[model samples]
Target: MTKKRALGFGYLPQESKHHFLLVTPRSPNEDVAVYERFDWDESENQETGIVEDNLRVTLDRHKWNSIKDFLTTSFNNRLKENDVTVGRFKIGHVPIERLLGKEMVLLMWAIEDSDPQLISTAIKNWSGLSREERWWLFTMANAITGHADDKRGWRKAIRFALTENPIDDEDKSQVNMFEMFYKNVK
Candidate 1:
């Protein structure tokens, strides 16, 4: 029997394979590029770890900082839950825990083309969202524009809703993310 692992929202119980996000930081670590790769044929892999990855998004150091703390805290918490040792993210591929990959990708899609100055705002709005809400947003985004390179449709809508429209913390509690997303799309 396959071992069942704790998963995040919107994930099927049977989907337990790990997805990795590759983070490549330029010299001086000014600009960072993040990529996601999913392996379809695990059994075919023999020796080489090489795999094709989609370029999700690139973040400047400032923008990366805005979300780093949140990712670190939440990711580490997830690792602890799975009885894995939490470690710092070096300049390489980081194994995303369960559905955290979805959350990270969704957030990145929202701020990929946004103004760097507004990243804090995006992070604030993103952090206010419940995990289920984030998962739903990710699902919709992935359904239409899951590819890292795709910048239109749901990807654009996510950016518009998350960065351009700032939701106050109090209002966020009552706000429906789906409605917000649809408003942007429409």
Candidate 2:
């Protein structure tokens, strides 16, 4: 296995309990980000890493091109705020902030099973949502259908809201659907 580069958002490299976005490069422009959920367990030792097969979102060149600028810019800004050297790269095990991990996973979950052609649409809708909105949506989804193997419930609902529902005249169709789902999640 190639040594993966670690991108930190809110935690240091030593933090093992937080989630990770393992970006494995396939080619110059192609890579797959495996979102691994690492929950702390009392019985298990932390030295041995535990990577739950949570979500695999393949970001091809096109998809990467669509969101690269936004992601790099946003992440770099966060890194600077964390008092880390800006634009530094490292190898092996990417560590993302807990909330950032949730946001990224939520976006990945939304488009995991979507049509490849409609990625731009999904990304557009995702970008339209504020960080708080994204975090809230992730919180709701993670609370119920957050496990690596659980792929229904809020997960399915998120896919439907972002991918199936396109931009509308009001622009709140997707957002509205998210609110509606939140209300009906019981």
lDDT of 2 by residue, 31-139 (tens): 5565655564446553355444455345455555555556657667766665654332233345566666666777777777777776666766776778798889888
Clashes of each: 0, 1
- Scored against the true structure, residue 51 in model 2 reaches a CA lDDT of 49
Predicted candidate 1 versus true structure: per-residue lDDT over 1-186, tens digit per residue = 332343232222245544545464546566666545454234554114434345556666666677777777876676666665565555544545546777887787787788887777777777777889888998888777777677899889888877877576665543566888899998
Candidate 1 TM-score to native: 0.69
Residue 21 miss distance in model 1 (angstroms): 2.0
Give the Å error, residue 119, model 1: 1.3
Task: Note the Cα lDDT for every prediction shown.
Answer: 0.65, 0.62
Candidate 1, residue 115: CA error in Å? 1.2
Structural RMSD, model 2: 7.6
Error of 2 at 128 (Å): 1.7
In model 1, pairs of residues that clash are none
